[model samples]
Target: MAEEKKEFWRWTESNWKSPDINWNDAKYMTVGIDVGSVSSQAVIMADGKVMAYGNMRTGSDSPNSARNALKFALEAIGDMPEDRMDYCIGTGYGRVNVPFADRSITEIACHARGANFIYGPQVRTVLDVGGQDIKAIQCDEKGKVTNFLMNDKCAAGTGRGMEVFSDLLGVPIQEVGDRSFEFKGEEPAAVSSTCVVYAKSEATGLLRKGWTKEEVLAAYCKAMAERIYSLVERVGVKAEFAVTGGMAKNRGVMDRVMPFVGLERMKTEWDTQIAGAAGAALFGFALCKKGKGRKK
Candidate 1:
């Protein structure tokens, strides 16, 4: 048999719930669905605390993606509490398409709130690297967005860029960070960060010139970091910088970007990708408490 091909762009995903929460006893129940260009998430909150969540790759159909995310979350908790939900909020690129959402909020607001929830009230800044865009947000103590900047014109420094590089190097997406560090000697020059096409061409040339895959990886990662640094500069980096979205998991990129931007990474045990959905759920919880839910 021919050697099996390696897939470098696939990322890890999961569904989880807090084991400590008693779903039946909660006074209020809310849900948040975040449907982005490349992924979708459903978050279940009971009385403002995260009870469960489901995340998956986005498919061609937005409504189905939203429904499937909720289905996965409900299955994880062994319950069908759809009727019990007091409010449901939708957010992200496909927010409006969420069939059951009572309201829609922007991903910037959701991400700010989610970061504040995970990193605490002290979080004042967020960098979200989504599949098709990159966002740098500044928020207040209450997780309200005060200012933000985004780069969506190209895929050079976003998750898609990382995926492209991983596929080219034949390394798993999760391992791209570690593989980048394997390169010894002087750090390679940064590649073009203006466009993924140019960067890909540069990588190919580097490989043809006897550069190791690790060296090419280092150059690509550095370029991505630098590109993001430029975008974040427009928003003005405040302390307590928290990174969210799919790219936060890439330490290879974060390791280079954090230093380039001059800030310490906010540590968190929660899944970074769920910030937007979790924030939307928190908003739903707040709205429910205010008796503003459409269900009411």
Candidate 2:
């Protein structure tokens, strides 16, 4: 039999519910759905506290992705009925496609709000390196966005760009971070091209010139770091910097970018990928408190 091809770009999917929180006793039950380009997340909050969440790969149909994400979260709370949810807010690239949402908020605002909740009130700067774009946001203690800049025109420095490299190198997405640090000697110069297609060509040339896979990976990560740093610079870095989205988990990029940005990332126990959805849930909760709920 021919050797099976491994999917190097695939990432893990998961769902979780808080064991300590009893949704039945909560005064408000809110839901947030974030259907992004590469992934979809659904978060359930009870009285402003996260009760359950699900993260999964986005499928071809965005509406189905949103529903599937919500179904995954509901699995953790077996008895929770969808109709019992007081409010549901949608946010992300496919926000308008969330059929069940009462309102749609921009991912930029949601990310800032979610970062404030995850990293605490002190978080001032949020850098979200997502699949198709990079967002650098400045916010106040309450999670309200003060200023922000986003780079959506290109895949450079984004998760999708990294996935292309992962496939090109035949390296599993999860291993890219550790393997990137395995290169011998000094770090190689970053790949020169900001365009993914040109960068792939540049990498191919480097490999032909005797560069190891590890070295090439390191160089690509370095390039990603520099590109991300440039985006963050436009919004102005602040103390208590926080990173959200999938890229925050990759030490390859985070390790290289932190020193350049000159700040320690704020710590959070929650999954970084759920930030946008979590923020949406929190927004729903606030609206519920103000007598705003799902439209009849």
Candidate 3:
């Protein structure tokens, strides 16, 4: 918790790598700011190294969240020469509200760009399961978004859903994976409800039925798995996949996704988090490579 919180404050690495920015070729490095529904993130690429990067919680103010996320990145750079900053790119729901951003991009493009950059050129698909949204994107070899799909209208199978379930079982979000891992027998919870509000109601019933916490968690995993597969299936279920965003941190979901997709085509590495941040940082490098400039 403390380490995650520190990202919002600034760069703290004792040993920082120099980004491979050609001083003669370009000016300032590029910045990527992702202001998500529940959290905000920033990344800076200078020279050949990721100069500074950080993420902070997004409170009620979306605009400030975007600005603060960028500021946090600067803090991480720890006296990084300000003159080197050449361009700024913003994304996520709050992108349009980031006053300091030179240009705002759609979250879909941002996620796709971010994912392709982190996972490498061969990444064919990305399951960006965010806090309040679910975005599935396909990308080309150059890290450009090809075809994508998203769902933001509801709250089923998202980070928010997990938080609610965590509270119902009296478990912290961090403890869910370990607790679920401890169970011996299979006891699934009844989560027939899709809407978040209704899911809460159903979770309460499962609690009343004396379902062990692990069983309930497992059931919830499959339930969310159901929703996630719907999106993955839409992208036509391809190989070389990646999953990004905050919820990508959930071990249970990570444990469940590849099996549902099948190990033969899945290629193993499914459970992940912060792939979005990695992607954002990679895009920052891209913009720098292109000698990009932006205003307004």
Candidate 4:
């Protein structure tokens, strides 16, 4: 048999529930489903705080992805029935495809709101780098978006772009961050192209010329940082900034971009990938408070 190639770009999936929270005691239960191009997240909130959440890879069928994410989350609360949710909101690239959602909100708004919740009310700026796009958003104390800019036209500077390099370099996606700092001497200059196709070719040539894999990884990270910084510049950065999405977990890119932006990222105990879904859940909570919950 031919040797099986290891998949280096896959990230770990997870689900969790707050140990102290008992869903049966909650007066209101809400759910938010965020189905993106690369991943799907489901967040269940009891009253206004998170009770359980699930993070998983997005499937080809968006509705199925949404259902699976919810099921995964519900697994954390074994006896909770799906019908107990008072309201449901959907967000992200596949927001419209969430069949059970009472309403759909834009990821931009959801992210801003979620950032406020995760990073605290002090967060006024949020940079979300997802699978296929980047978003820079500025919001007020209440998490209302004031201004935002998104680069969805290309895959450069996003998770997908990093995945391509991970495969090309034969590095595990999780190890790319730590390994990038292993090269000797000063950091190398960034790769020339922001376009993934052209950049891949450039990396191949650099390897042929004897550039080490770590050096190439560092260069690509620098390139990714520069590209991301450029987009954040257009919308402007504010103090108490926070980063969300998959890229927030990648130190190779985050470390490179932070110095350029000149702001320390706000700390959050919650998973960054769940921001959009958490925000959606929060929105559902607000609607429920307004007596707008789904009618039986």
Off by over 4 Å in 3: 1-27, 47-49, 81-83, 187-190, 264-274, 277-291
RMSD (Cα, Å) for all candidates, in order, is 1.3, 1.0, 5.4, 0.9
lDDT of 1: 0.90
Candidate 2 residue spans exceeding 4 A from truth: none
lDDT per residue, candidate 2, 173-193, as tens digits? 989999999988999999998
Candidate that beats the other on TM-score, 3 or 4, i.e. the better one:
4
Task: Work out the TM-score per prediction.
Answer: 0.96, 0.98, 0.83, 0.98
Candidate 3 has a TM-score of 0.83
TM-score of 2: 0.98
Q: Tell me the whole-model lDDT of each prediction, alpha carbons only.
A: 0.90, 0.94, 0.68, 0.94
- List clashing residue pairs in candidate 1: none
lDDT of 3 by residue, 1-296 (tens): 45442122221122222354333454447777777887777777654245556677776888888677767767655666655677777788777877777777787877776666666667778888887888888888776777888999887888777877776777777767567666675546437876678777877778688877787777787778788878888876566877787666667876777777774323323223335544555565666667665532
- The local lDDT score (0 to 100) that residue 8 gets in candidate 2 is 90
Question: Would you give me the overall lDDT of model 4?
Answer: 0.94
**lDDT per residue, candidate 1, 86-154, as tens digits?**
889999999999998999999989999999998899999899999889999999999999999877777
